[model samples]
Target: MSTPATSRARGVERIIDIFRQLHAARRPMTMRELIVATGAPRSSIYELVAIFSEAGWLETSGDGSVFFGREMHYFGADYAAHNDLISRAHQSILSLVRKHDETAQLCTLEGNKYTVMLSESSSRPFNISSDIGVKVPIPWTATGRLLLGHLNVNEIRALIPDEDFVLENGTRIAFDDFLRDVQYADAQGYCCTEGLSHTFRLCMAAPIRDRSGVAVAALCFMTSRDTDPKKRELMLDDLIKSAKALSEPYSRL
Candidate 1:
């Protein structure tokens, strides 16, 4: 037994679902695509998109494709500037880049995924590729292990549905082993993973906490395993210092 008001509310929710789909796609979408994606009628798709566009929540291109509008970006940037745990830590990130001469990355845990929000590439001839705006499974990366430290083993396993963690290059870590490594990282105050992606690549990561003392992100550096021992120790020292420095600004936000 549903009232007319309840049915109308359900219809509005469906429209909102469609809007979220467009926003997540991060590109212009056609009405036909929206209809298919939302499973809404063509008329309903046009009606909803028109309403969103009129309110400046969506913008349509000359080709009749639609995307999230400038308003969304403006609002997102505003929220990110204030809410972003990484932007507040920029000074520390910059220091690490300058001190180590290797690329540094700032990664945050967003639900179950690890997203690289900012990174500074090394000035050296060889450095890892820019990882900004990339998402990696939390168990498959050094930074991911640090991010997982915020959660207990059972919580981490619940977040990741797969039984095993796999790298892009066909390397894999069993779930039990991955959990053990995360526990080890928690004990060590940092995480180190070698050859997860490339054969000789090495990565070190430390967690960054917000004002509430919750580990919100991981500051990580990638380099070759063959890096000179003296240089590696110096870099690790800087990384730890930077992590502490970054934690200070986070309290302000």
Candidate 2:
């Protein structure tokens, strides 16, 4: 049987886990939903919420719902600015966007996920949409899969938890299936995805490497599959070239 001290420690861990879920949500979470999602007792969860709210790590709304606080934004932004990989490659990203007339994104490894640090879209309104500062799971995504190709199979498996690949709205390809796709991308020099985001949207991605040839980010081009294949190939070639150019600055930095 566990002692009272041991039980208290478990409760603390459960509370922290709940906080992480809230952060991962990337949006406000109601008190009831948080409790249901965590399977934690309402009273204990509320107590931790109150404590976190007081500490400014969690912010509660008028409806008593909670979300991550301003402190998180400050810390996340500050970290990105100081993160050398992102700071050194901003100009390259800008150049890619200008050349492609589509969306250009820069993502960096953050724990087991890839966080979008910098993104730009061309003024033309042809499939030019992307999110900045969003953290996406590093699987089942064109850019994510290419990034994972940098690591060996065992290393990739160790970094990602078994359940992390499943997303609410995306198809959950088996781990082995995902690995095969990544291997194929590595051989082809780029990754292409169809209907990953929308039924009509297509994405092509290539890995951005560091000095030692480890992938640090992905340079991607987004367009519609309805577009001409020749146009898509043109965009893919442009993206590959841009990634090569982008890698030079970071590789030297």
Candidate 2 positional error at 237, Å: 3.6
TM-score for each predicted model, relative to the true structure: 0.76, 0.72
**Candidate 2: where are CA atoms >4 Å away?**
1-12, 108-118, 121-139, 150-181, 228-234, 248-253
Instruction: Give one digit per residue, the lDDT tens place, for model 2 in 104-196.
Output: 777666788766667777787555555665666777468777877767889988988777667546566588988888888877778998776
Local lDDT at 160 for model 2: 83
Regions more than 4 Å wrong, model 1:
1-24, 98-102, 120-135, 197-202, 210-214, 222-232, 249-253
Candidate 1 per-residue lDDT over residues 79-170, each given as its tens digit: 66776465656667777888778888877766677777778888988887435555567776787776676677678878985833777777
Candidate 1 — what's its lDDT? 0.75
Between which residue pairs do clashes occur in model 1? none
